[model samples]
Target: MGAVLAKSSSFLFILAAGYLLKRFGVFGKKDYAVLSKVVLNLTLPAAVITNFAAMEWSAQLLLIPVLAFLLNWLMMGVGLLASRRQAAPTRALFVLNCPGYNIGAFALPFVQSFLGPQAVVGACLFDVGNAIMCTGGSYAFTSAWLRAGGQRLSVRDAARRLFSSVPFDTYLAMLVLVVAGVAIPQGAVDFISPIAAANPFVAMLMVGMMFEVDLKPGYLRQMGLVLALRLGSAVLLAVAMYQLLPFSLPIRQVLAVMVFAPASVIAPAFTVKCGGDAGLAGCLNSLTILAGILGMLCTILVLGVA
Candidate 1:
């Protein structure tokens, strides 16, 4: 128990350092945009390639992506339901709020530490699934909403837009790396290792940057409904699935705990780029991430792992 708390504290501290750096104006707005591009286009993809390239493919692994989509969709449903009785901003918050673990940086290493090497493969699968759902599913949802508001996107145009996105490219590169059996040079691997290693720090720092934006107090009160539904649903579903699924205890527990992880930090940014509400998305994203960290710790304790 002390060991787990030690590791968790170390993660939060690094996260706090990033936030403090952002808070003190060590980086300007342009710097964040620059950082975002570099990390999304180069560092993250490289990390995914290095990780996925080493994993052996399996049908069971495919289940991870499918499950990820279902979970996101389920969360989306919760958001939509919440919005039906609320205002538009609130609705946007709910929909944008629904996502599973932040793969690659935040969840991967933590998972690897507890579950060993095999969990890296699960991370890869989860990443692929998340990319598809966040990219493809988000586009579809936005298209519908925009068209209802008198803006329509043709099938070709939507596909072209999605293809041009970085997440799509990252997913494609990871797939190619996994299928082709190519080996990255050790020097190149060394170059990327630090970037990948710095992932969680990047995530927490982004949260701090959002904090600097000075959101309304009422906005947070409004978010309380969403926080409960989204986080609670994830934890409850994870527990139920872990117990009922026909799998080994380890896999069940890991999957359950991971589900409780915060929504992917990148999703709100993606939502903004894809023409969704970036600020509202950021609000939900921040709160969920804060909750996810707590929920995941609880999940780990429940699983009886030290």
Candidate 2:
């Protein structure tokens, strides 16, 4: 418990530093886009390539992505049902914010520290599905639903977006290498190592740069409802995986930590693109990061090094 709390505090301190930087104009709002691009295009994909390139292959490993995809769809359904009575924009934002865990930035470090290399591979695999959802899947779904009355959602456009995403492309390349028993060259891995190491810091900094808390009555109510459902689903899913899944302890641990991960960092971007409320989405994203950190701390304490 002490160790977990210490790590949690260290993580939060980094977050607070970023927040302070942003607050003091060390990082302007527009500067966030620059940091975000670096994270998405460089560090994040580098992290994925480095992790997945070294993963040991197994049929059981395939279950991670499938579980990730299913969990995302389940939350989307819950969000849809919960916001059914809301306006189109709010409903779309609610649903968009529901799925897609922040696996790469927020969850990976903890998994790597506690569970070791093989478990990190499982978490990376799960993040493959999440990358797809965060990159294009949620946007496509929301756009289709929002335009159900008129024009059709452009499947081709969505596919193009997904393929063009740096993280998704890296995931595909790594998976193919894994399938063919091809190893990334030692030189290439070494080259990416330093950049990959920057991923967690860049991710947290971006979150802090974009952080905002809106206490307006209507927004507060809506955010509370959505967060409640999101965290509740995470708890239920984590409990089920821990108790009933036949996987090894490490795999179960990865699954549980992932469930408690916050909403994707890309969610607010998608919300803006879908004509939803970017401010609200950003608020939710920031709050959930804090919530997820606290939640994972409790989880580690409860589960211990199982």
Best TM-score among the predictions, by candidate number: 2
User: lDDT of model 2 at residue 284?
Assistant: 83
- Each candidate's root-mean-square deviation in Å? 3.9, 2.5
- How high is the CA lDDT of each candidate model? 0.63, 0.78
TM-score of 1: 0.78
Model 2 clash pairs? none
Give, for candidate 1, the lowest lDDT window spanning 10 residues: 145-154
Give the Å shift of residue 82 in candidate 2. Answer: 1.4
Least accurate 10 contiguous residues by lDDT in model 2: 146-155
**For candidate 2, lDDT tens digit of each residue in 228-274?**
98888889998998888777777787788788888987788777776
